[model samples]
Each structure stands twice: as C-alpha cells, then as structure tokens.
Target: MSIRHCYLQALALSTLLLFSGLSLALEKPIGPAVLRISGLVTQPNMLQQAVFDMQMLQALPQHSFTTQTPWYPEPVKFTGPLLRHVLAAAGSAGENITAIALNDYRTEIPFSDALKYELIVAILMNGQPMPVREKGPLFLVYPFDSQAELQAATFYNRSAWQLRALQIK
Candidate 1:
C-alpha cells in the first residue's frame, strides 16, 4: 500500500469519529428540562434544542460570588455554573443572547459579558435553592461587586431572573 493511501484512510477515519462523537455528546434530559437553549447551537438534544436538567447544570464547574442587587435587601451569595460554560455545552457561537424569563420579560445580553465576567446561571442563593417565587430555579447573576460599571441599570436589566430560555443570535 502506498503512503499516500494510508494517510487518506487515516484522515477519513478521524473525520468520521469526530462527527460521531459530536452527536453522541448530546444527551436527552432525564428530568424536566429547566433550561432550554435554541438557535445557533451546534449540539441540540431535544427537538433540535439544547435542554438541561438541574443535575446536568450542577455537573458543570461551579462558580460562586456575592453581590448586592436592587431586588434584594442585602448582598447575596450566588452559586452555579458559569454562563460561558453553559453556552459552550450547547455549542453556541453567537454574538448575542436573548434571555427570556418565565413572566415573558426578555433582555438582550451580549456574548462578551460571559467572556468578560464570571456571570453565573445561579441555581442557589445564600446556600439555599431558590424557588420560582424567589427569582429562580435559575437566574442570570452578574458579578456586580467585581466591577463598578456592572452596578449600573443596564447591567441590572441584563441580570434576568426565573430564566427559562435563551435564544442565541
């Protein structure tokens, strides 16, 4: 067999394996999907959308930070996976994200925010699970205390609560 033939065969096998792995990486949610990410995603598990159960989100690297918000009387500790990590799991490659809450309130968050700060999709506040009435099962919590500029109204608006879905743009 020629060396050229061997090289071509190896390349073909690697390409096939890569594509197979990508499909296998997407798993259906076992429990009710708490979060749904659609549009501009490479990996979609449920009806061509990326859906996550609470356990799935908890499996990712955890990030915690304390920050004061207008919604709360005092500084609260927020804990969950970083937004960028969640986006990566969805295979999202977009410039913007339209975060929609359960109440239908929506906000546009630049993708750069995820990259620039340790913005968390918070599942816990002050070491306790937050129910829907408390602004979660999920909340997009910015590290407001980390940067002075993040304390502004624009950033506050971006900190969406009761987050249900994200539409990548």
Candidate 2:
C-alpha cells in the first residue's frame, strides 16, 4: 500500500529468487554427471552428494595454462575451473581433499593447495576434451612448469586424472 511496503515486497521477492537459483544450481545433471563432491560440504543434492555435469563446471570461471608434466613429452594446455571455485560451489569446508579416480587411484590433496597453487580441475587437455581413456572428463592438475617446488613425485602423484569423486575431510 505504502512506498515502504512496496520496497519490502520487492526485496523479499529478490531474496526468494536468489535462493531459488541456488537450489536450481544443484539440480540433477541433465547429461551424465562428470564428478561428485561429498563430505564436509554445506550443500549436497544428489544422494547426499553434489553431482556436477560438464556444463555445470564449465559455467564457472575458466582457467587455462600450458605446462609440462611427466606424463607429457612437451608443454600441454590444461583448462577448467579453478579448484577453489569448484570447492566453493560445492560448499566444501575442509582441510584436505581425497581425490578418487576412475581406476580407484586415490590421492590426498591439501585444501591449501587451492590457495597456494593455481590448481585446475582440468576438463580439457591440449585444447581437446579428454576422453575417459585419456584421463578425462576431469583431471586435477598442478602447474608443474610454473613452479619449481611442484616438480616432484609428491606433487605428481597428487595430480589425479580421470577424477570421479572428491571427499573432503
């Protein structure tokens, strides 16, 4: 009725829409789910896990870099959302992440890696989408060439490929 009431109503509606959008972001994947994040998270939608389709991850801010790795003979381009952004989207609040690959190869990645290193949840390699056989739909990659400290077996083993799930602990 009054101007104050109208303003309050508009604010309420906007707040409702904002929360609705967040809920929609966690909706079941339209295509196959590329990754699942579970444990120590604020949001869990699918079977107590946040399941992400390729498009969902792609929607985040993309980061790309070319670097050499033990697996590759030459510098290769890796592209995907930053690990921190992905964790934030999933509402992950943990000190460490246990990355599990398709082959059941698992590695523990410190949460600090997201801050200390420009880690990427790599969706593409060498400008091409990685097939499951080639270590894709997802890979956790560190910029080994960018930082000398990351060029060791410890960091190499922590770079999980064919990443299927992440459990925060």
Candidate 3:
C-alpha cells in the first residue's frame, strides 16, 4: 500500500470517530447480540451499554494475523476488527477495560494495550468462525509471536476467549 492510501484511510477513520462520537446512535442488532460494551463511553445504544451483533462487528474494518498461542496446537489465523476501532465506534474513553467471558471469567486490561498493540476481537479462527467449544463468538487476542513482550503471561491472560462484554473505565 502506498503512503497516500494509508494517509487517506487514517483521515477517514479520524473524521468518522471524532465527528460521530457523540451522535452515533447504534441501530438494533439484526442478529442475536453477541457483545455488550459499556462504561465511560460517549455513545450507548442502551442506557449505559451498546450491544452489537455479528453484523455490527463485521461492519468495521477487519484485520487478521496468524500467531502461535498457548491454547492452540499450532499457529492459527485469527481475524476480526481491531479492538481500538470498536472502542472508537462506541466513543469509549477509558484507562482500563474489563473483559467478561461467556463462562463468567473476567480480566482487566490496560486501555493502552489496544493502542500499543494490534489487538483484535477475533470472530474467526483459522479462517473459520470458531465454535463455542473452541473459544467462540469473540476472542480478545494479541499478536503474541509478533513481539517478544507479548509472549508473557500478562499478555496471554488478556487474550480472553469466548468474550461476551467489556466494561471500560
């Protein structure tokens, strides 16, 4: 990709996030709502939470990476929209985020991690949608193999699978 293309993409994203932060009204989910993001956000579809379905998540720009993770037997390709973009769409402002999994597991992650790393809310694993048994509808993943720092347990713990909700603070 050319520098000009990158510049244009950045410009478009900046304008979208900045101008729509306050006025973005999320539409009712067309499919089953899969994720809820609440707390410290400028825009919320519900009282304090913004719910999203698969279609909503897929609407954002998608990114993918193949990485070796502790849970997987081999390097697997994961794909989803960048976590930062999702937060930006929600008009989120926070120092931290609490990820809640389907089984009630939760973990705290610094907000800076999203900006600092190419973290993704993975909806696909190995180019296919993951089943709940395999860590499903959503997974907060870090590109562990991309950087030595990401290989640590701190980052691994942040890679919450079967993710259901996020509370930003």
Candidate 4:
C-alpha cells in the first residue's frame, strides 16, 4: 500500500478501537441493589414507612417539628420517614452505616440508633422541600428533645443532613 493509504488505514483502526472502549465505559456498573428514591412521591400505606423515594417522601403522611440546629439559629420544621424505616428498606442489621450527601459529605451512624431509637430522615421542613442551603432533601434527626441521651454532640454529628445515600456495612 502507498504511504497515504497506510496512514488512513491506521487512523480508521484507532477510531474503531476508541469507539468500542467508549461504549463499554458507558455501560452501567453491576452489583448492589441500587434504588433511586429521588423525585418519587411519598404515600401512606404501611409500606410507606419502609423504602421510599423523594417524591414518595413528599406524598407520605407528613410529620412536622420545629427544632434548632448548630447550623441554623431559628428552629426548622423537619419532615420525612422514620430512620428505622430507611434501615429496614436497606435490609440493614449492621453496627455502622455510612451516609453520603449529594455534595459528597459523609458520616457514620450507629446501627443501634436505627434499631432502638426513633431517628428520622427529614425530607422536608416548614411544609417545603429542603434546599441545599437549608439542609434539605434528607436530614437524619434524633429526638434530642424527647431523649436527653441523644442530645450529645456525637449523636448530633451522626445526624447527617442533606443525605443522598446510605450504605450499610
């Protein structure tokens, strides 16, 4: 083959290989029972207390409570499913869980809290969705007012706000 033809052939072969690799990379990664709970409406069945998406969270029976946080001055109304419900959905029975936020912030919570305490994943506040600045979408909260033991700073730190993911390990 002439020099120009040889160069064209090599270019075509490289392009084919690149496209093939890109296709494979674009394929979804396997493993894990990934459930998306965002943009789904909350409902009011017994199962509603279990696994739920964001839209479902909004639709479910609403519970509102105003509480103060270190991040804010005035108390904020928190609404969402009980933490126990979320744990049950994940089939979690471990001692620790890693909660990740949309911004990649993460914290670890004791499994005992979910199993024994009335912690909640607050999806709303003051009858409105929680924006990122307001610690919205999802906020893990312990009944600090009801349970004095839960008012400690350690528990407060574990009460991750703006939560997006939960991995029980």
TM-score of every candidate relative to the true structure: 0.85, 0.83, 0.86, 0.63
> Which candidate number maximizes lDDT?
3
The per-residue C-alpha lDDT of model 2 at residue 55 equals 89
What's the candidate order when arranged by decreasing lDDT? 3, 1, 2, 4
lDDT, candidates in the order shown: 0.84, 0.82, 0.84, 0.57
User: Candidate 1 residues 1-169, lDDT tens each?
Assistant: 4568545534443454355342326577898989999986767888779999998888877889999998988999999988877777777656688999999999999877876888999999999999999999999989999999999999999989999999987
Q: Give the higher-lDDT candidate: 1 or 4.
A: 1
What C-alpha lDDT, on a 0 to 100 scale, does residue 162 get in candidate 1?
A: 99
Best by TM-score: 3
TM-score of 3: 0.86
Candidate 2 lDDT, 1-169, residue by residue in tens: 4568545534443454355343324556788888999986656668778889998888877899999989988899999988877776676656689999999999999877976788999999988999998988899999998989999999999999999999987
Task: Report the alpha-carbon TM-score of model 1 versus the true structure.
Answer: 0.85
Cα lDDT of candidate 1 equals 0.84
Say which prediction, candidate 1 or candidate 3, comes out ahead on TM-score: 3
Question: Could you arrange the candidates by TM-score from highest to lowest?
Answer: 3, 1, 2, 4
- Which residue runs does candidate 2 get wrong by more than 4 Å? 1-25
Return the number of clashes found in candidate 4.
11
lDDT of 2: 0.82
RMSD of 1: 8.7
